[model samples]
Target chain A: DQQVKQNSPSLSVQEGRISILNCDYTNSMFDYFLWYKKYPAEGPTFLISISSIKDKNEDGRFTVFLNKSAKHLSLHIVPSQPGDSAVYFCAAKRRGIQGAQKLVFGQGTRLTINP
Target chain B: EPEVTQTPSHQVTQMGQEVILRCVPISNHLYFYWYRQILGQKVEFLVSFYNNEISEKSEIFDDQFSVERPDGSNFTLKIRSTKLEDSAMYFCASSGDAYNEQFFGPGTRLTVL
Candidate 1:
């Protein structure tokens, strides 16, 4: 079962504009959410994260908002730059059946920032 | 600046041959993990290791898959018999604590032909 889902397969935004990527999860047990940025032929790099306890978390140009009631979260990048063009993945960590740290990931959304 | 490192950026092996992927996680980090991503797919967790033992594994980690921490700094994943379906980019990650964020390696592209 896909516990995490990124409905939008791709997104485009003009440079200096705002870009928003959305993600949803089916598992209510997940409490920690994270966003990762990946470039071709490279491993994903952590961008930002938010805990269920907080509704939002901001890191410079990136902000993540979580809505527990809706089981949804979003990442917002302000003043999007061409460098921001990459695949973004949403991940959630939940206690596994064996009480282990298991991260469930979404399919990923390809973000393209036009110059 | 302590990041995870993986060897052999790319590997090509014949089907049914055994292959070993190596990783060296950051020093002082305890929790280690392995994840794989097929082209155009999301990253899937394969296994997590702690205290020199496997803490968790997904269904994808079947009989052909195994992990070992042969020494203090090296972690390895072994595929007893590689299949074409096993071709993917395998990533190694490490975190200092269970709830902490993980750092990932550049990834090793394993192509089973």
Candidate 2:
């Protein structure tokens, strides 16, 4: 059941620095990759997503880079802020029967931004 | 900014008791799903519902588990017999379409004593 994996369990960065979080997947059938941020006692919130057809997708301070050949994807947040400190999860979507799809999530990396 | 919502933020039930976790998907969304996460574990998909029927289910969604959309706005996950391993955070999500990002509701923490 380890189709998606975020090897880093925790990451720390200072304010105004770039924060990079990496994820890897073993399943090639995944059609989309997404990054989710979660806080304690809360559900995951989608931040950004990239389609398999593209190599990069960016939204404001967040950018996601995908390398299909290596089966790896990474999220970069420039000038990371304290508010960005939370558990970050990488997820992959695969289409299922009847067009229903499900997201497979990683173990999550706890990102801590120090002021 | 319509968002998914869930009820009963926390529930504690005795083993073997039945429990139902309720969720209200975003309005105009047609697809719904249930996922759960045990402490320190990855979120696992339980089932996906579409067109009033279960479109897909994972192995973890065994005979004891079921999902229903009894009303227009409400989706629910019911467990016939709660077990110790059933204690986890159950999340509900919905999407306007099948391939896009699915909005998630604040999870309901279920504890089977």
Candidate 3:
């Protein structure tokens, strides 16, 4: 079963506009959430992350907002640039006692920023 | 910034053959992990290793699959008997600590015939 889900498979936005990608999770145990951006043929690059204790985290032009009650989170890119076009994967982790926490990933949303 | 590096960007092997995928995680990172993605599918966790031993593994990582940190720099995943379903991209990742962001390699595409 997909514990983390990104229902929107694709999104298109104009350059210089805002782009919002949403994700939902079924596991309430997940306490840490992150967003990664991947380009064609390249490994995923970390973009932003938020801890359960916080509702929002901002890094440069990217911002992640989390709503624990809704089991949902979103990544917002302001004044989106063409370089922002990539597949965005939302990941979550439930802390474990012994080992590194395993990440549950969404199907990924392909964001296209039109020039 | 340090990044994870994986070898043999692509590999083709016969079913039932043994195959090993190699990765060198960032030098100082302590936690290591392996994840796989089947074509057109979401990425799935395989296993995690630390301090030279496996810390956790998924159901998909069965007896046929094993992970080891053979040395200070190299971490490896070995599939004792490959199957057609084994064709997928294997990624290596590392994190400095638990609950920290992970750095991923470009990925190794394994095609088992």
Candidate 4:
């Protein structure tokens, strides 16, 4: 299913520039949105999350903005570091029976920060 | 930090053989899940387990697939008579509760010959 989508397959930014990765979803029932970072041959690591009640959430140099009207979300990283190079995946969560909720994930966007 | 752990990082078996993938969820987590990612595809949910029973499952999870928590800490996914389409990376995940943030383990790559 294409409920969640990351249209950008890859992104490149200079070390000191701002990096932006975008995501979109067709499901309105999704109440929670999260970003995950993944390295080669490794499991995805949780980075940040935002609840539907809020439009923006920030952590350190990373920020996530959700536009409910557009059903779109974007992750921004400032002063991008080389360490930030990895595949970023966007996921959404909906309430499920007995609380064993499952996640719907988007195709990952590979972010590369060049020094 | 507490994290989910998986065994048999990689496995190769005949298409008709049965295979079991094992995982150890975080100690304090109460929910468990399995998701698979085929090459060059999005991660898809297989099933969710809670209180020793399956609470939810996806269309991808059919008669050939089953999940079990035989003990307190271990979770296992068994595929009966695997198919070539079943070759993919299987990830084990745990959350503090349903619809909560989840922690994932390094996936086990299953290759069906």
Candidate 5:
């Protein structure tokens, strides 16, 4: 069973525009959420994260909004650059299913930034 | 900036051969994890380690798989009997604290024939 889902397989945006990537999860146990960006052949790199207690968290040009009640989260990259073109994955973590628990990940959505 | 790193970048092995993938997690990090991503698939957690012991593991991590912090700076994953289905990119990650962002290594692409 997939607890985290990125319904969209791909997203494209004009350079310098805002790009929004959406994610939904079915597990109510998930309390922390994170977004990762990946280029081919490299590992996923951490972007931003938001806990269930907070509605939003922002880091530089990246912002992540979490709606706990809706079990939804979105990552927004403003003034998207060509470098931002990559695969984006949404991940979720519960407090403790096991000690030092692990994060459950979405299938990932490929984002393309058009110049 | 310190980063996690893996060795052999890519490994090719025959079926049923034992393969060991090595990782050097960031120093000062207490939590370490192993995750795998099949082509075009989500990254799935395999195991988590802390204090030289396994803290958590998924069903996918069967007896065929083992993890160890054999020394002060190295963490390793050993697959006892490789299978074609085991072919995928394996990533090693480490975090300073629980629930914090984990830094991942470039990954070791394992191809089992």
Candidate 6:
């Protein structure tokens, strides 16, 4: 099922530039959105997350913007560093009971930072 | 920081053979889950366990699959009969509460011949 989609299969950015990665979802029931970075042979590492009630959430150099009306979200990293080079995945989950809920993930986008 | 961990980094089994993947989630997390990712596909949810029972499961978690928490610190996923399509990376994750983000283990790559 293609509930969540990351259209960009790959992205390249130079050091000190802003890197923007976009994602879109077709499910309106999804109330939570998260961005994760994954390295080869490693599990996804959480970067940031935003609830549907909010439009934006920022953590240090990373910021996530959400637009409910368009069902779109984007992650922005300023002054991109080499360490940020990895595969990025966008995931969404529906609101449910007080327990672990299933997450729908998008096809990952490989981000490459060039020095 | 405490984190989730998985054993048997890689496993290879013949088709129809039984295999069990083990995991040790974060010490305080109450919710545990199993997810798998094929070589070129997005991660798919398998099942979620809580209070010694399965709280949720996806369509992919068919009759051949089972999950157990036999001990205090261990969670396991067992496949009674493996198939070629069962070759994938299995991940274990845990969340402290309903609102907290789930932490994932490194994953175990299972190859069914």
- Using Cα atoms, each model's DockQ against the true complex is 0.64, 0.70, 0.73, 0.73, 0.73, 0.63
Give every candidate's TM-score on chain A: 0.95, 0.96, 0.96, 0.95, 0.96, 0.96
Clashing residue pairs, backbone N/CA/C < 3 A, model 6: none
Tell me the tens digit of each residue's lDDT in model 1 across A32-92: 9999999998888999999889999999999999999999999999989999999999999
Tens-digit lDDT track of model 2 for A27-87: 9888799999999999999999999899999999999999999999999999899999999
RMSD of 5: 1.0
Please write out the lDDT profile of model 4 over residues A1-115, one tens digit for every residue.
9999999999999998999999999998888999999998888899999989899999999999999999999999998999999999999987543563888999999999999
Residue A105, candidate 3: C-alpha displacement in angstroms: 0.3
State how far residue B43 of model 5 sits from its true place (Å).
0.4
What DockQ number belongs to candidate 3?
A: 0.73
Tens digits of per-residue lDDT for model 6, B14-48: 99999999999999999999999999999899999
With a 3 Å backbone cut-off (N, CA, C), the pairs that clash in candidate 4 are none
Report lDDT (Cα) of residue B12, candidate 2.
Answer: 98
C-alpha lDDT (0 to 100) for residue B43 of candidate 4: 89
DockQ-sorted candidate list, best first: 4, 5, 3, 2, 1, 6
Tell me the lDDT of model 5 at A62: 97
Q: Which one is best on lDDT? A: 2
TM-scores of the candidates in the order shown:
0.97, 0.98, 0.98, 0.97, 0.98, 0.98
lDDT of 3 by residue, B1-113 (tens): 77899999999999999999999999999999999999899989999988787888999999999998888999999999999999999999998887788889999999998
Please write out the lDDT profile of model 2 over residues B20-100, one tens digit for every residue: 999999999999999999998999999999999998899999999999999999999999999999999999999988888
Candidate 2 lDDT for residue B33: 96
Tell me the interface RMSD of model 5, in angstroms: 1.7
Model 6, position B86: C-alpha lDDT score: 100
lDDT by residue (tens digit), candidate 4, B1-113? 99999988998999999999999999999899999999999989999998888988999999999999988889999999999999999999999888668899999999999
Instruction: Give the residue spans of candidate 6 off by over 4 A.
Output: A96-100
Q: Indicate the fraction of true inter-chain contacts that candidate 5 also forms.
A: 0.79
For candidate 1, the per-residue lDDT at A56 reads 97
